[model samples]
Target chain A: MKLIGENLNIMSKKYGAALKAKEAKPLQELAIEQAKAGMDYVDLNIGPASKTGVDLMTWLVPVIEEVVDIPLALDTSNVKAIEAGLKACKKHRPLINSIMVRPERMEALLPLAAQYDAEFVGLLWGPEGMPRDENERGALCAELVFKATGEFGIKPERIFVDPIQTPVNVQQIQIMSVLEFMKMFADIAPGCRSTIGLSNVSNGPPDHLRPILNQVMLIILKRHGMYSAIVDTYDTMLHEIARDKHPGLEALVHKVEDGEAVDMTHLSDEERSFVKTAKVIMGQALYSDSWLEI
Target chain B: MTFQPSKQVYSGKIREVTLGSGDKAVTIGGRGVYAFHSFEGAMPNAPRIAMEVWDKDPSEDWAAAAKAPFGDVLADPAAWASKCVKEYGAEIIVVQTKSADPNGDNRAAADVAATVKKVVDSVDVPVIVWGVANHEKDTEVMKLVAESCAGKKVALSPVEEGDYKQIGAASLGYNQLVVASSPIDINLAKQLNILLGNLGVKAENLLIDPTTGGLGYGLEYTYSVMERAGQAALTQEDEKLQQPMIANVANETWKCKESNLSTEDAPELGDAAQRGILMEAVTAVDLMLAGADVVVMRHPEAIKLVRNYIAKMM
Candidate 1:
């Protein structure tokens, strides 16, 4: 499984200096920690720097790249900013993160991705809206895969598909959609890899609760064949759990992926409540106790 | 969809274990697929034989088939072992400690150790010290045998459920390879392996004996058990069942009634000597295909036939 550090985005803007004269100490620290925690790639997302997006990404890519040689995901809403970061990444090619089904952005990004020989990331969303069901997401992903191979000449193996995760608080159906999309994505594009911006699923939740939400979602998502994850690589607990692999965790993940209720009687009351919340979000069963102890 | 054979992908590999330190050493296992699935996996080391050399005298009350080839060396184990390696090109020598059996002469441990020492000093090839079925007697004899061949790196046998701690401790102390012997039960075999591991036996210092049965004597059950153990090692990635296996083919085949009975006694059964040799040979070759890495056998003709079979298979 590939772990991507997602700490250097607009979520922590104070660490991103104007000209990087203040040494960008926090940015370097997070990169080092993520790399040490066995993250195969570090994500450098200077979110929405419209006026200075290109310059900030260009400066930040090298600062993180200078410390760790692992691959970086050049994430930005603007296509030009991703291109600027691509130029600065000297040694290892960066995976472009990411593009939707918008034609204009796809035209600018896919060719640059092919020209640089870098792997690309594509989302399930199009110009109209995000897909509401599994086959809808699968059809959209299959279209990108066909175009990625036939039009741009980028190999299917090089593209990483992100199904565009939605927070369960807003719409619960998306949890099942994400799992189904992940399960079906491999068959849709045989050699392509499946990934998720894992922290987004826990968005808007309390900070203390976010870790459990993110980790549990990752566990279930992995069972559905989500091989790559963009997470807080600095969280030592995630690394510990990953290293100490357990059969029970896989059993629970398997049950959740199958959309069946798991036997959570062995877990603590608090842990079971969290799992119960997950069952509600995953649509495996109807919500019973909203006043549950989570 | 077009039909395609699903390729087997495994997460674990058999540990390659070597006995006898230097040039004449033999290593087995380490393949990641079924016995001869060389197209998908590696088969690095070829299977070898450990020719039998008995501690008791072979002349008295022994079958004529076994005594024909080893007539002169029957009384002397060292001479028999030397003839096995030098004349027949046997890969390893197995000194069967039959004299130490309680029902028989019940020879002292020192006597068994002395014969083992002579065989070890006589043969350049690696030696395997097989104990009699008596647990307490084998523990006593193997302790002495382990001291006799300290640095020779011999393989000690019959480390069963009851005597694993005793035999396992002796093997560890002397740095010898301990064969985890179990009945024709895969679970018992795996459990005994776990016990040996708990006794501090490294993966590289262990062997498996699923207990051989002669041809027409429940050989199918033995074959199935061995096949299942191989599947666990290669496909399912169970580490404990991964060690190379051995079967005392000569012991089971020679003692069978069909092989030992003469034409006069049972005229329907043809030549007793010829039938005996074929029985051992057939049992040995079948076990090899069923994933036995080492086979201990009598009769030079039987050994030759098995060698020819392995030549084509390996």
Candidate 2:
């Protein structure tokens, strides 16, 4: 699985302070570490940089580029800031962190993405906001792809469609909806890659139990042909599972996905936790902060 | 509308592994696409054949045609290996240590190591020492073989899950290559490669043996697993499964009843000689298509047939 580092975000407390101060050291250090951790791309999530969006992106893009060799995903709500970051990317192909399915966002960002010849993630959030089900996601994907490829002349291969992951604790039904959307994504927009904000699944869960949900969800998503994921690069075990170095764990998760009656007594502690977490995501078991304890 | 062919864009490439050393070293596995899909991407190294030479004389049980080419040197593996290289144009020689099997001659590890060294010295090309599947015996014999041919870069085959530690350490200590063997399952194959890597086997010093099965004898299973291995290496970009694969086609193909059953015993099966050669060639070709980097083959005619097929395909 291709990993887009989600650690260097403007939302993190330390990095957010550093971004506000325009400090380059902390961001550069984190970028280098993420690349060493085998992140295929680093997401520069300068969330809604409304005031200093353009200047922060223009300055930060080159700052991060100078430190790491991997590509950068320019993430922001500011249209001009995205274009500025795209212009500043000299070393690698830049990915526009998102272009929403909404008309105003598409009209503003699609042409900028096409002009820069940049790859963009197609976020399946319609004008009414978050799709009701897989069918709604599918319809939004068709409209976004048709405009991106048909009108802007952008190729499908360059677009990554994100079905928008929902937290498993409160939005368990949407967990299955996104998976259903992923199953039909290729048919809807052939050659378009897919990614997800993997941490979203565990958003409402306790901090200590978040990695388990993310790891299990990653394996389940990969089985359904997820191309990439925006993930916590520092989670060593999660990356190991992504590289298929832990087949035993992946097989246990697959067993839960396949609906096999797993004998819990025979599993190791880690394998048993993976099974439980997968069941929660599949909605076979109720979600709780102490699910692993159960 | 233009007819645009839907070609898969692979994000990974197989790590190239070099066998032997000096002038005659052969490198395999550096392809960015599936085996023989050169039109889509680059397959820099073509699949090769390493003819097999057994440690013990097998004229008693061997079919007449399989035995005909090396009749003069059947008793001596060094001589047999020389004949394969000097006459038949073999690029690599695989010394099958049948004598070390505890159920067979039960030869001492020292004796087998000497035989392997002799064969390695006799050939200009790379030598691969194949062991009996018994873990304890292969560990003992291959450790000595690794020592005897230190720095020669000869490969130790069938270094399985049971003996990867002992043999993998010896290969690292002596600068030899290891063929990581597993049952015909893609998961087990990747797991073994991961184990070997954890044991410090570098990417260039490893080969995958997914446990070959002959035509009509679980060939489909082996083929599918190999194809999956190829896809995982190139498309899924799974680092552990990216090593070039080596299929022991000769051992599996020649031993099957379809290759050995005489026409008198089974009249409808046709001539035993031609049938065995075709079976070996067909199995080798099928395996190459499914991503075999090197196929251990028997019978000069079968080798010739496979060479022609590879040449035409390339």
Candidate 3:
């Protein structure tokens, strides 16, 4: 899996302080750690960044670039800020974090992406907002992708289609819808790649329980052909699974994903946890705080 | 879009590994494309064929067609290697240390090293010393051979998961290259490469042997594994699995019972010599298509045929 580190966000207490203070050291340190953690890209999620978006991104891109060689995913709602970040990405192709299926976002960002020759994620969330199901996601993908490729002249290879990930606790059905969209992504876009905000699946779950949901969701998404993911830099277990180091665990997850009759008694503690977590994500079992114990 | 072909966009490349030192050193791998998909990306180095030279005379074991070209040189490995380079236009020579097998003559490590050194000395091209895959014997023989042939950049083959530590360390110490052998499984192949990398063997000093199987004998399995390895290296950006692959095609192809079956015994099988040559050539070509950087082949005819195929493809 091509990992895009999701740690360099303004939401992080430590890094958010650094971002607010315009301190390069903490952000650069996180960037280096993420690169060393085997991340293919580092997502600089300056969420919405409406106020100082442009200047902050301009400063931030160069700061991270000073330390690590990885491409930075310029993530923000502010179009001007994305352009500032893209301008600093002279070494590699920077990714414009998202171009929502909505016209306003597409019109603002698509030209910037074309002008900079940058890769951008085609966020499936249309003007109607969060897609109802796989069909809606597919329709949004078609609209955004056709415009990006057909009108804006973006190559299909440069587009990364993100079938938006919803928290498992709230929208368990949407998680399955995302998987269904993944199965259809290649057929829809053909050459375009796919990525996800992997941590979103575990967002509302308890901190202790989050990693399992995220990891199991990753294995399932991978089977459905996820090209890359925006993931935590410190998630070593997730990284190992992505690198295919744990074949037995991957095999067990595949069994669960395949809906095979797996006897819970035959599994070890770790294996049982993964199986149960996968069940919750697949909506085979209902979500609860103490799901693992159950 | 009028039925456009889906082209892969690769983020990683196979590391190019140069074998031998100075003048005749040959480099393989370093491709940003799948096999020979030259239209999409660069295949910097064309696949090379390393002609096989046995450490011991193979009059009894080798098929008649395979032994026909060497003639008098078959008795001496150095002479055989020289013949391969000078007469056959072989760019590389692989000295097969079959006699050192614990099951066979069980030649001492020192004895095999001496013979391998002679072969390395005789050939201007790169020399790859292939061990008999017995973990203990390979470890012993390759350690001495790496030490004896220091600075030659000779490649030590059949370095399995069990023996990578000893052989890998030897390669590291002597600056030799290692051909990490694995079963016909992409996961095993990547695991062995990872193990070698952990032993401080640089990517440029490594080669992957996904264990070749001749035509009609698990060739499809070998092909698929190699295809997957190439896919991972180029598309998935799997750095550990991106070392150029070397298929030990000669041993597997020639040793098959069909290669030895006489025309009189099996009239419908056509000429024995031509059949063996075709099998070897077909297997070599198939492997090259599946992303083999180097194919260790025995017959000159087969090598020439494969060279032609590569010429056309490249």
Ranking by lDDT: 2, 3, 1
Q: Which 10 residues in a row give candidate 1 chain A its minimum summed lDDT?
A: A285-294
In candidate 2, the second chain superimposes onto the true chain B with a TM-score of: 0.98
If scored against the real structure, what TM-score would every candidate get? 0.53, 0.56, 0.56
Residue-level error in angstroms, candidate 3, position B255: 0.9
Model 2 Cα shift for residue A62 (angstroms): 72
By lDDT, who's the top model here?
2
Worst ten-residue run, lDDT, model 2 chain B?
B185-194
Model 1 per-residue lDDT tens digits across residues B137-242: 9999888888778988898898898898988898889899888888887756876787777779998999999988889998998998898788767765566778
Writing each residue's lDDT as its tens digit, candidate 2 over B163-234 gives 999999999999999999988866567667777887888989999999998999999999988987787678
Q: What is the TM-score of chain A alone in each candidate?
A: 0.89, 0.99, 0.98
Give lDDT tens digits, candidate 3, residues A1-294.
999999989999998999999998888888989999999999999889899999999998888888888888999999899988988787789999998999999999999999989999988888889999999999999998899999989999899999989988667779989988888888889899988999999987689878888898889988888999989889899999899888888888888778896898878999999988887677655554556764
| Tens-digit per-residue lDDT, B88-162, candidate 3 | 999999999988999989989899889999999887889999989999999999999999999999999989989
Candidate DockQ scores, in order:
0.01, 0.02, 0.02
- Alpha-carbon DockQ of candidate 1: 0.01
RMSD for each of the candidates? 22.5, 20.6, 21.6
What tens digits encode model 1's per-residue C-alpha lDDT throughout A1-294? Answer: 678888766656565552344356788888898788898888887767687778888778888888987999988888889889889899797899897867877888899888888887888888778888898898889888888888999987789998877765445568788877776776789889878888787676566667766776776776677768888877776655455464565566556556675667688774575565556456443221221331
For model 1, what TM-score is found for chain B?
Answer: 0.96
